[model samples]
Target: PGLEVSMTMLAVDALLDEVAENRAHIGLAYNPPPHARIAYRASSAQPVVLLLRKDHPLAKRGGPASLNDLQAYPLALMPSTFGIGHVVSMAQVAANVSIRPTLVTNSLSALKRFVTAENFMTLVGEFAAYRELGSEELTTVAVAHPLFESAQARVLVKADRPLAAGPLELLKWIEERMPMFAPVKRPARRKPIR
Candidate 1:
């Protein structure tokens, strides 16, 4: 398992529930709490929150806009039950509008594609959008809402048993090597668990 890894996509709720049930080789869940264990975060650089093409009106606005300002632009958001569902939920509350997305998708690529094809925007973790934003394929935008937060993906072993040697090795490798891979500027610092 040098380069390949096992991954699964489940709503944050289910992910938590499954992990809580303690029944699988559950390694690395994002947006965790009841949903995850063995959290591993490797970024230590500035993270950009993204929007679509610069031509999109929200991206082109004259001055800094609050969450309310983002209300007018249709979004491509993950379903509210997904990890960090609060991002959308908070944006709506702050903007004080019954805002709904143009599309909701788990596929980050699809969200990026929708933005390119339709000028719609959404907020996603900087790491998720790193390459495109770096290559100029997707433009980064600022969300005036300090409501923004980053999440740590986690790695969990199956219930009762500890991690297998190989999986444990990979986990250690990630823990030791990932910080170097972070995007240049981190949005927040990664503090060790007290």
Candidate 2:
């Protein structure tokens, strides 16, 4: 069969649910539920970074600000349903300081647009803001805290089905390019029931 890929965006729970239902063949996500078989590919030490406009005060003062330092400014945050939200929540508890963002939205584009024009900030994975960061439209400072030390990213495939040659090859190519800090063992293939 000629190879074609379909992509859709969903929150972690919904994404895994679709995978479990065999509605999707592959997914890229962080800390997906363990019930789904996962091929651990790479880890990122700074999964969450504070994103600010290039000339924002914090951006001007900084190289990796602590959560307390971030608390001094207004924030724009994703709702708790997204993975980044959960990470920030954990960091919040660990730091014992409440973060009350001036704006909260699930749309990354909304956060991107708002932060560029306002004195607000938000947290996102480096990949999410890769282009903006490269263009100097935004500056990212890692949240220097133990709770946000590192996060692993993995590829998920359904265990009930054997991966076809095309998809398998694509997966391998992705693994090769991933920013894996160190080698991680691939998930074992599930044996077909006799």
The candidate that wins on TM-score is 2
Worst 10 residues of 2 by lDDT: 37-46
Error at 25, model 1, angstroms: 3.7
Error of 1 at 64 (Å): 4.7
lDDT of all the models against the reference?
0.61, 0.74
- For every candidate structure, what is the RMSD over all alpha carbons to the true structure, in angstroms? 7.2, 9.0
Clashing pairs in 1: 16-35, 27-156, 28-154, 28-155, 45-185, 45-186, 46-185, 46-186, 47-187
lDDT of 2 by residue, 1-194 (tens): 59887789887677777777778777777545465444444444546788888788878886788887767888888887667777777777877788778889978999998888888888887778888888878888777876555754567777767777987777776666665433566999999999
Kindly provide the TM-score of model 1 when superposed on the true structure, using C-alpha atoms. 0.70
Candidate 1 C-alpha error for residue 11, in Å: 2.6
Cα deviation at 174, candidate 1, in Å, is: 1.8
Q: Mind giving the per-residue lDDT tens digits that candidate 1 earns over 42-98?
A: 433332255678787766764555566556777788778765465557556776767
